[model samples]
Target: MSTADDLKKLRLKAQIGITTVLGLVSIYILLTQPDNSSLQKWAIGTLGIIVGYWLK
Candidate 1:
């Protein structure tokens, strides 16, 4: 494969890894502290950004 392909794959992997880790963190926080609306909103917002970047 080309260098471009490798770079693309690396970017995709990074994005997926970030999304997974953040998602897990959010789940833990939600389970442990359900009243923290700010953190939850932040998590959702970051995920939205990631999703938007992924879509773009």
Candidate 2:
């Protein structure tokens, strides 16, 4: 593969990793912080996933 192709693959992987981490963190907050607002977290997490999909 070309250098550009390799870079693109690396960037795609990073994006996926970041989105996954955001989703997991949101879930953790929702489960652990009962007093905190979960709706906001859910919205942020969903947005992250959506953005990632859009990027791909």
Candidate 3:
């Protein structure tokens, strides 16, 4: 209804979209790799979490 409300809605939509995309990408990456390589994926996932937090 108002400008602030509109901006908040947009931000929420963007966050949801980005989170969904990230989840899919992570799943794809993990599935494509070997079991032995999971540790590396966990490390990268940790770093991604940290970076994503900082970004927010």
Candidate 4:
């Protein structure tokens, strides 16, 4: 594969890995939190995932 193609594949793999981990963390955070303010953490975690994927 060309260098560019390799880079693209690497980026896609990174995005999938990071987003999966972040999603799990978000769920854990939401589930463990007693107060309803966990929504903020969810929102932020989602945004982080989005930005991370987008930047890839």
Candidate 5:
């Protein structure tokens, strides 16, 4: 009902959406075992970045 509430809702939505998508990416990478290490690194790095950003 207020600007602060709106902002909180927006932040929550963005966080959830980004996290879910990145999580799926990590799952996909794990399921489809890429031969190149870079893909695996990307999956790990992305999830790490998300966790680091949100948890902080």
Candidate 6:
């Protein structure tokens, strides 16, 4: 593959990794913390995933 294709694959992998981490963290927070801020964190995490996909 070309360098450009390699770079695109790397970028996509990074984005997926970040989104997965954020989603896991958000789920952890929601499950462990029964508070108001968990909701906000979850929302932010969801938004991050959306924006990540949008950017991709």
Cα lDDT tens digits for candidate 2, 1-56: 57998999999899779877777776666667655476656756677776768777
1-56: candidate 6 lDDT, tens digit per residue: 57998999999899779777777776666677756785867766686776777686
Model 5 residue 18 lDDT score: 86
lDDT of 3 by residue, 1-56 (tens): 57998999999898777777776666676767777687547746855885686597
Q: What is the descending TM-score order?
A: 5, 1, 6, 3, 4, 2
lDDT of 4 by residue, 1-56 (tens): 47998999998899779877777777777767766585756756686867776787
For model 3, the stretches where C-alpha displacement exceeds 4 angstroms are 36-56
lDDT for each residue of candidate 1 in 12-41, tens digit (9 for 90 to 100): 899789888887887676667667589877
Backbone collision count in every prediction?
A: 0, 0, 0, 0, 0, 0
Candidate 5: Cα lDDT at 55: 82
CA lDDT of each prediction against the hidden true structure: 0.78, 0.74, 0.72, 0.75, 0.86, 0.75
**On a 0 to 1 TM-score scale, where does candidate 5 land against the true structure?**
0.74
Regions of model 2 farther than 4 Å from truth? 36-56
Which prediction has more favorable lDDT, 3 or 6?
A: 6
- What does each candidate score in C-alpha RMSD? 2.8, 4.0, 4.6, 4.1, 2.1, 3.6
The candidate that wins on TM-score is: 5
Structure candidate 4, residue pairs in collision:
none
Best by lDDT: 5
Question: What does the lDDT read for residue 43 in candidate 4?
Answer: 54
Worst 10 residues of 5 by lDDT: 30-39
Return the lDDT, model 5, position 16: 95
Q: What clash pairs does model 3 have? A: none
Whole-structure CA lDDT of model 1: 0.78
